[model samples]
Target: MAEREWTTADFDYDLPPELIAQEPVPERGTSRLLVVHRTPGTNPPREDLAFADLVGRIPPGDVLVVNSTRVRHARLLGRRPGGGPAEVLLLHPLTGDRWLAMGKPGSALRPGKQVLLGDELAIETLLVRDDGFREVRVVGADAATAIERFGRLPLPPYIARDPDQLDEARYQTVYADREGSVAAPTAGLHFTTELLDAVRARGVEVVALDLEVGPGTFRPVEAEDPRDHAMHEERFEIPDTVATAIAAARGRGAAVWAVGTTVVRALESAGEPDGTVRPGAASTRLMILPGYRFQVVNRLLTNFHLPRSTLLMLVAAFAGHETTMQAYHHAVARRYRFYSYGDAMCLI
Candidate 1:
């Protein structure tokens, strides 16, 4: 089948509500791993294993590419000037102190209006956008500082619980540095500092990239036809060190395993048609569906995603749709955790 002809239903699968993990497991590496092997004309049965066994699966000299984009406290509680409760989820920063944000009853916020974010924090609406988002300039304190004090962790709506103190650390990866993303890279959340050190000690090279996961990542694809879906561009960067590491790994015939879809998008976005990856920073709106040729990633590490979600489509593109769907069915039957803070999968 042609890549562009893929439909959203191609990625659809049933998931029981009880399987959706509302909270993370107490032990980071104690979560289960479902290893799916891909081969021509056959769906390989998944191997159930613990997360700690992941390092053993890595071939020597392989490069693990990870997205180090940190999750920011972007969910802010605020009020309209007249004191009505309001909520704002910052999508991305525009210019200066301005940001593109989605607010509850966002259409009610008119241009030039001021919203009180906290006791002393506020934002002045500069313009209303065509997409119903608001362009607002932060007031009273630096945007970062204010968010640190008042913003809550932007947990996925399905969690059904308030953000706890543990979330501030558990939700973030050990290597996170760039503070721009509102959502945590779920795949990276499984790795602790000790696990990373162990992987490195095994002679597996680890590299980092930056892809600020934007609000669009959480937005469900509304198009019945997957081709009609417009993927929102996210800013990403591939440092020289990481680029060099990938090149060296490929030269030695070692696999380049991406830690998550974010890393896959970043690497594939920077890769040439000839499969050579370059070092650079740019915006990527690339969408991966079945029959899409992969230029860089050889293996994928990811969490179970929502049904009919773009993330599920990307995994289907990596491993065949039939294989992925069957694995999902098995996961549901086994009652493995699903979604963010859920169980993981390794596709190779």
Candidate 2:
């Protein structure tokens, strides 16, 4: 029989606005964790746990994979000619000095127009996409240097305030490196160096990969049928060392715990048809819907996602659809924090 069809509604839930966490917790490792067993079928298939319990919960000798893509300071404020303010949010970089970005006040972005960036640099619009993004080229400075010097961190829309110094440090994971992503791999945000050291000391093998997260992370799924949604493409790279480690772990019957959904996408996207992982760099637009086979990720540590989001559907596909939704409702009823800077869940 064909797999049961799923709609966008099947993955949605009601959330109180107050439950949407607007600020990060005081300490990196202090957020709450809800543990969900994928096989359970009762009223609630999850149990509440503290983030500190993670090291003890994960099985010894299991391999843990994390995404180390750094969150670039991609949001920049500038001025259009005749004194109108403009904002440029970088999506992905192209050649050395060009970027695919979205500019505010569309009128400020006609081809040949220049947005004066603060660091003695400027960007000239070369093309406007039908989707309202612009293809722009830096005029006087290296794109990377300009961004690091003057651009602000790009916080999620729900954050509700301007980026501050605290946000620059707190918004990224301790392991973040090789900068490119517009958004942080949030589930990784809960871990600090101390926490990671503890996890490693428990005999769990820890490894890293890069998945340059993009705006698609926050965009709501608009398709009526979940399968019709076009997944966003993000760049990823897997080293031979990490690939061999994961293969060895699976060969020994050890669990492969993905630190975040980004890691899940990176691993599953790199999986070969024979269920082995390939080591290489490429872009992936892979979407995980119900009935899809999971090749490598055996456990997931992820943040609660937005209603009707592609992320919600992904978690449903990993865990059972009904069981995942029940756990979400249970989380909401019990006042768990939601979204980036919110709480997390470990589904096994």
Candidate 3:
């Protein structure tokens, strides 16, 4: 028989509105975990466990890789000169006090227009880019200082409430170090410092990479054919230490565990056909669809993604399409929380 053809619709499933997680659990490491095996041609069984049980699940000699990119306070809510509400989300820094940002009321934020972010911080729209983002220059204060003092967390639109003080810490991972990403690598959110220490205690080597997650994370695959969707370029850095650790693990027959899809993308983008990763800083627009071969990331730990999302497609690519869809149905049937700030799944 010929291989089956897959489309964007094949990767989507219905999710109840109530299952969308509105908030994080009271404690970081207390969420539920749904573990599934990636082995094909078998009825995959799920092992329900606590997030804290991760330390006991991984084999001792395996290597765990995490994205340590910190979420930047990039959402600047302000008012226009004429007193209309305005919002600008900083996407990338271009030069001194200037950025490529997404501005609301796009028609109004043309060149020379200004938005007052705070009493002393304002942004003047310069030029609109080919991609529809606006080049803006910060005035009245240093861009970094202005963002730190007045910017709010760029919470996902699905979260109905405004970002509160709790979100300031809960939205980020304990190990977040490099300050660049507009969004958090949420799979890392389930790990507490104590849990990380415990994993290390079990002889698993933990390493870090930085992938400056872009706003595209919130975008869904709009193309009818999944392969036609263009991925946003994300800047990532794989340090010498991480490459060395993964190499060492591979040499010893240990599995390489990617903490989130972002890590998987980075590793696979730099991966050699032999499963060895090249270490360096780079940007990737590589999209992993159902038929794409994965050279790295033997194991994956990730959150339940949105319907019609590239994240979901990548999961389908790593785990089998049938297995992934079945697991999603199981998760929904079992009332597992979904999306960012939701429960996680471990695919082995």
- Number of clashing residue pairs in every model? 0, 0, 0
Alpha-carbon lDDT of model 3:
0.91
lDDT string, candidate 2, 27-98, tens digits: 889999999989765445678989989889887789999999998888888987677799888888887667
- Which candidate, 1 or 3, would have the higher lDDT against the true structure? 3
Worst 10 residues of 1 by lDDT: 1-10
Model 3: per-residue Cα lDDT over 1-348, one tens digit each: 776778989988999999999999999999999998887654547877888988899999999999999999999989988889998888889876678889798866788999887687788999987878889988987788778887889999899999999999999999999888889899999999999999999999999999999988889988998778878889999999999998888899999999999999999999988788999999999898888889978999999999999899899999989889999999999999999999999999
| Candidate 2 displacement at residue 45 in angstroms | 2.3
- Per lDDT, the best of the predicted structures is 3
Sort every candidate by TM-score, greatest first. 3, 2, 1
lDDT scores in order: 0.86, 0.88, 0.91
Flag the better candidate by TM-score, 2 or 3.
Answer: 3
| TM-score for predicted model 1 compared with the true structure | 0.95
Judging by TM-score against the true structure, name the best candidate. Answer: 3
What 10-residue stretch in candidate 2 is worst by lDDT?
38-47
List the candidates' TM-scores in order.
0.95, 0.96, 0.97
Q: Write the per-residue lDDT of candidate 1 for residues 1-348, one digit (tens) a residue.
A: 433576787777877788999989998878999999887654446888999999999977999999999998998888887778878787788888889887776644678777787678887778887776789877888778768888898998888999999898888988999898988889999998899988998899998999998777777788999878878778999999988888888788999999999999999999967555889889999998888889888999999998878888899999989899989999899889998899999998
RMSD of 1: 1.7
Compared with the true structure, model 2 gives a TM-score of 0.96
